[model samples]
Target: MPAPNAAAVPVTADHGSATWRLIKAESKLCLRDKVAPLWGVGFPLIVLIILGAIPTLREPVEGGGGLTYFDFYVPVLILFNLAILATAALPITLAGYRESGVLRRLRTTPIGPARVLTAQLVASFAIALVAMILFLAVAGLGFGVDLPRNPFGFAVAWLLAAAALLSIGLLITALAPGRGPASAIGTVLFFPLMFFAGLWVPIPQMPPVLQTISYYTPLGAGMRAFQDAYQGNFPSILPLVILTAYAAGCSLIAVRWFRWE
Candidate 1:
């Protein structure tokens, strides 16, 4: 009988080609996915264009160190893009693959569940990065919005936030029973998280109590980090710590509970 895990590629072999191919395939699948492409990439760019067209949004945010309302929202939308990819698109697709036995079947091939998971993560990260660049491009060229002043700090914050969000995605996939539940759970998370990310009201405009609460939410901390980067400073330690904690805690739990079949 074939070993169930015959597909688990081991070290000491040049597995780079296989890994690269898997990533390419997964990235193609992500691009072909209607829901993720629509909401994750297209939605954010469209909203950015609309916001840029609004003259009122060009006004400077009070106490934002000369950042326009449009500028503030650029990072919010970036966070939103990541949220959709992580919470909605990723969990749902993986759960569906699980439900349909795709992950289980892969164990019999040259590629295994672990590699597939890595490919999915790479695809999602690539998509998120592309969407972010698109957002910045449209904002900069079409609307004259400046890039983040602290580019290194901005990159750091973005990486941490992505790790935190994607780890949560894996946790959702590990915990949910099937695709439907995963989608439902993701939907339930999407709105409230976006709320804390300042999707509507500016964080500063929020009531003091809510502002205090916001900093504790995932996107809230991420938005704070992005804002600090935009203002030419490293993100505060609190938000970075919060993001790292989430990434570590959730990833450990997800790995503990994740199943192949």
Candidate 2:
């Protein structure tokens, strides 16, 4: 066997075709990872269903702006699925790839780390979209939760939220020493994000100071945008700016510090 030359791999190519192939390959790899689907799709759906079954949760509440708890939960679960995929599944997979020398091996081939990273990101986005659809379908049919009243606004907020969370995942993967460390760091961030997203306490019910701070967390800003869209209002500029800041700031730092090995 002969050793491969790092610089021998050509960078130029029909990027469209190459990127599509890379996405397809990453999709297959994602499917093979049982944990991704379990946490990203199944667990969230299961939680939503269980929560929706609560009698009190199914009833409309006055303080909830005339919507049921289930309605509020619809967006919560939507963001929750993406958050799990971004924080828990993505960083672990990318870090593990590096740990297993897959990324290093690709460096000597025509396929480079940038392509693989983009492919993984695209594939993860696709999976999260599927999970979102599943949650909407199940929630609508099983719990009578209404779809977002402002579809376009909902979509914009959703994209911003996804970008912010995915950027954080990349930053974690870039910084962690190994896959285990990456997973631990992601898990540590997840609980706080979820809390601010109103998993344990609705934003309206939180103390004034906590509510102020929650608006600044990525998931908090996301949850606000999602809820606003659900109420047929445009997501406010503040949440949009917050989401953009997290996405751009984390992505910049991640790319600047990223290491192939």
Candidate 3:
């Protein structure tokens, strides 16, 4: 039998163009999904309102001056919303693309498979940024939450948190090849992370053991870092450091195990 012809393999020199095309396509598709945008953005805002309405939340802090519970919880709420969207939506989108042969089909085209992944990342990040802006707007305008005193610190914290969450999402997509299972895994992670991270209840109110564990969880650390930024507190090096480490570890696992087909 004759050996297979290597010349039949597809290759393209204009990979950058292909990547841009994929990014645009992904953006359009994501925007057209009414339910996703509602769930990703609206649900979080609703949670913020409900949490902010709690009587204890509205009462002044005992010794931390007169900051309202709404003011104090706003940062945690924003980060929690962003984390949930990243964890839940990203994995499902990726796994669905893979399961539906979107990635496999792209391999036969001039576009590289990596472009599809990049497009998905860019689209997801865009949605995340919008959610962050909406959260900030609502808090600042509607609830009298002040802007971050250190804008630079706030930006750094946000970027690091996004990176950490994105890495975890990618890791989930790599490990769970099917869309249903990927969503299930994300659901398993979503609530606990949010609750322990102080999205539902104040960390100080939790039991000592739970508080200790929460401090070490990625979502908790991210929320703490965000809270520090919003309150104009000096950036806490530990949470950012832990987030960086988690991002690195998750990225490594994702890259090693990811499959296109």
Full-model lDDT for every candidate: 0.86, 0.85, 0.78
The lDDT ranking, best first, is 1, 2, 3
Better of 1 and 2 by TM-score: 2
Clash pairs (backbone) in predicted model 3: none
Which residue pairs in candidate 2 have backbone atoms (N, alpha carbon, C) closer than 3 angstroms, thus clashing?
A: none
Tens digit of lDDT per residue, candidate 3, span 25-56?
Answer: 88888888654476678888898777766778
Candidate of highest lDDT? 1
Best to worst by TM-score, what's the order? 2, 1, 3
- Where is model 1 poorest over a 10-residue stretch in terms of lDDT? 9-18
Model 2 Cα lDDT, one tens digit per residue, 17-127: 676888998889889987778888889989998998899998888866778878888888888888898888988888888888877777787765556667877888887
- The lDDT, on a scale of 0 to 1, for candidate 3 is 0.78
User: Estimated TM-score per prediction?
Assistant: 0.87, 0.90, 0.85
Q: What's the alpha carbon RMSD for model 2?
A: 4.2
